[model samples]
Target: MRFTLSALALILTVAASSMTAGQSTSGQPPVTFTKDVAPIFQNNCQVCHRPGSIAPMSLLTYEDARPWARSIKQKVLAREMPPWFIDKNVGVQHFANDRSLGDRDVQTISAWVDAGAPEGNPADMPPPRQFPAAEVWQIGQPDVVVSLPKDYIVPAKAPDRWPDILVDPHLTEDRYIKAVQIIPTKGFTVIHHIRTSIVEPTDATLGSGKLDDADVPLEVGEQGVFLNEYAIGKQGDVFPDGSGRMIKAGTKINFQMHLHATGKEDTPTNVMLGLKFYPKGYTPNHAINSTTVSAREVDIRPHTDNVRSDGYLTLKKAARLLSFQPHMHNRGKAECLEAIYPSGKVETLSCASFRFNWHLNYVYADDVAPLLPAGTVLHSIMWHNNSASNPFNPDPDAQITYGQRTIDEMASAWISWYFMSDQDLKKEMDARHAAKTVPTSTR
Candidate 1:
């Protein structure tokens, strides 16, 4: 009787093993490219994944994408490729071109990869979408195109150098702008980042009328106001609803270019800003406000894996957030950006998964505006790497601080917003339309 019982137990174990294997292999339905995977890629990845885009590869077609099927599946499942830095569980924030993939979308792509990446029926395939040409300005035509007067040379043998350049596009009278776009004329390799500022003439003797000379020297931080700042892998600021900062007459635009030499000698770069103007009597709906967080001095022990630097800022009043941009340099360990509201509702603005090369400004859509009440505290946590494996590490032994160079590190989160009241926005618009001078330094 004991022998019979042992045999029966072995038989049942074999049956269970077979059933598990069958369920694993046969239970999942097959996924198709035309129906499942294509839609996801088209929606999320195609913006930067198309031909001639900044992305390393393309995912426009099944044939072009088939080779990377497994890679796509893995990266999406790992949540690394779409490059979003937000924690969705806290609050719903929708970006203009949101790359966040849903669980269902990920599952569909994974199943499609497992099903041998089948090309579904041609009739069911969606129409192929066309991508805009590279280097083409998105807003059709610009009203004013300002380029560097002369090419600036980048010294060879300098791995990373930050150069502050003054580009004087002298205008006669004050000009109101709606949208601004930056176009890199040359030296794409060495030019890693550019920060543009508007400099108003402090000296009345310098010029009152339109200046004909291109090389005009204007004080940067003296009397004029700083308009907007832009960086690499990001678009220039656009005040679509007539909300951009004004450039007063006799002001010059300063282009502070940050170049990474990359061991090459003497690179020359020229940059241009294409400006779009709003029609007369138009006013912008929103204004942009930025809060910068940095770590200039912090004790980091050698050989430590995750050295952290923290900073916090509390909002004095309520504001409607329009967009967010997170900045970090090489050797950056990790970062968490979030806001704690007055009511204790915490919203995760962005949480980057430790990559310094892919820094970008995340722009949100209209439907999901992250509203911050008064007494909200914005928190930032930055990490650093002082190890040998880091390629961009300037010195593993020495301490680093906040600077423009790649060797030195920085942590900054810039948030842009419009005023809360529609009536106030309209009032500002009416004043701007009348060409009435409202104090730009009010903020």
Candidate 2:
């Protein structure tokens, strides 16, 4: 019962140490949810980690995130969440739609987790981010919403389906579209990718194509001119001002879908296409030419790592690349886009780590978008990992070849660009060079 002064001090020191075990002792305040971490979640994780998203869990509130604090810390520290896989070490680093967290944001999350993931003052929490109401259309309200004629149902277990569903747009006059978004209304788990094309009235008959469960499409008729495509993580496409993709009057909208199957039975699911039109009577100066360079002879061996493939596309006319989106199935590891100029200079425009779940299109800033000469060649290099190390690989035992199914493998670079005259390209390049060379103080 006798307590010395030193004994009392020791007890108090132990209590203080217990209270601040994982917290900073250098006078810095402890990291808390409301004040520091919520803002970071709002800006980055909230987009896909919120409810109604493909993410398994939500991180919208303290209650929601506290349970997964350690997991969150692990993902952010590893640069796995937020689903941005752009390799920062090499190639072009700038992108208009970079969703990856900053170095400090990752640090903050790690610290918060270490500091017990405390929920500080509720008042310190930032305003909630607003999302779309009826649907999550990143392109906003569209001038027209096109739906598949009938909802397509995938069985509990089935091979990848590439059924072509045709629906007439019934447009009375030609319209230039600035944006396009295709969203799967249901069965997000089983949905693979949805590709759309416009079958102009000028073309021949819109043929029918059916992909049986065991069958792979060899030749399925005209795919039509591609309008746009949607994958699991694609936000949508938005063309620059004064440029767009045109939908001719009386055109049939072809929905070429790849719906794979999960173990459980999915509800009858359908896709919705949103098209935002340009202003009436406003003619676009340029037409967006969406193209791809595909390594058609894909041969991915089982238990292999770092499988390599290359594809090339030479510009027939001078063009400016607007976006770079790498396309692959489960085993895709990484891809790089390089510009092989006629002057013998090679430049890697971008190199992004591949995730089968997210086929994100990295758009370039308007000023820095690559403007290549007519003779410039675009080199697309892709890598595949088929070993046990690849987490997304469905089966590392099977050999994969180029096919339309989600199970099979392919190597492709999907890009959106617009062709321009030789003179126009030279003028644009000259303007760009002049801007960089101008003396800042002299101006």
Candidate 3:
């Protein structure tokens, strides 16, 4: 959570009020804007709900929120605001950036709406929050900013397009990158998502680093190292100190964009990516590895609900896991990550209530990172709902298969982790070589 200490205190204050009709304890005042609602909005909703943000309306102050009081109550009653869909009962509840409203907070909003959404006193409002300007980078400025070689035009009325363009940064030597941000010059409505990675031009024939229409076929079971991803509500992340990903010199950066055409006229868009590197000559104590656990041969039968697909990753060495991003297209229902230790102990890392529209990367809070020794197996299971009840279902009767289009389905989770030491890295490399000779099942 990006909430300040003072904002957290306000949350505690509202939570202290009884859930029963949002009433305060004896001798306390009723739930009011200054005392109750504004703080909750400030902490949870204001990130996207403020002016010039993605949300349709603003809820920053009493004047801004008063008109939408009843509407807010409706949305909260339906559990629609704040946009987090992770089931509280399933996953690790104490996430570092949890934006979900607590049950008591919901009840307080309900009670406030029931009580006419009163503005009890202007004096009780907390100090206004400070939001960064739109042009400013969320994690300060990046060391390098690379844009597309040329703008790509997206038709307004045609089907979606995945423009995979290759851009070369022309780095002379290796560098350790600490953070990255994906900035889309086009409006958000037309852009679905973007995935960026370093593509090694092993092919001597493919010489020029120019835009190519041919889709780069990713090898099966091949985990291409990714730099970053752009999705709704996603912000740039700074890796923990003494940790970063190593980027080699002369490597080509591939921009795999998933662009959706808004129902307007044709438009052109240019996207720029910003990269921040660690200090020159600085070596990271731990190197982060991003690998995808995928069940790409998905064949969801028509009208299937909760159809399960499984994938697994075996740790060849000791690793400290940082985050997991479960990804799927429409019809995706839920995703779970479990660790099967060498000693046979199974720990559930996360079992989130997944939504296709919200591609969330759940970063474990500090002191919560799980350490998996060699021979440990991590399992990924994703559930899909393709029945008529799924409003986002593109075709209820069509058998869904793995594809890049929005209509097609995908079942996968991106794993982010770091090897514990040099010995561990060597052990992992040896295990990978051994695995090449001995095939294993990932189910």
Relative to the true structure, how large is the alpha-carbon lDDT of every model? 0.61, 0.75, 0.72
- Ranking under TM-score, best-scoring first? 2, 3, 1
Better of 1 and 2 by TM-score: 2
Q: Looking at candidate 2, what is the lDDT of residue 366?
A: 75
Q: Write the per-residue lDDT of candidate 2 for residues 1-443, one digit (tens) a residue.
A: 22365456645654554455447684677888999999898878765677755466798999999999999988876677877777655555567777788766777787788788899899999989876543588998999999987888889877656788888868888888999999888776666678787776764233212112111112223455557777555678888788988777788888977666765676577889999999888788887765566675788889999899988877767788888888788899999998888887887788888987666677777777888787788888999999989988888999988776778877878777777888888787778778763111111
Candidate 3, 206-255: lDDT as tens digits: 32122131112232422244557776456677888999887767777888
Q: How many clashes show up in model 2?
A: 0
What's the TM-score of every candidate structure?
Answer: 0.67, 0.78, 0.77
lDDT of 3 at 302: 97
Residues 243-291, candidate 1: write the lDDT tens digits: 6545556677767666666354677888878777766555555444433
Clashes per candidate (backbone, < 3 Å): 8, 0, 2
Overlapping backbone residue pairs in candidate 3 total: 2
Which residue segments of model 2 deviate by more than 4 Å? 1-23, 135-144, 153-166, 170-175, 183-195, 198-226, 229-236, 248-251, 256-266, 276-283, 434-443
In model 2, residue pairs whose N, Cα or C atoms come closer than 3 Å (at least 3 residues apart or on different chains), thus clashing, are none
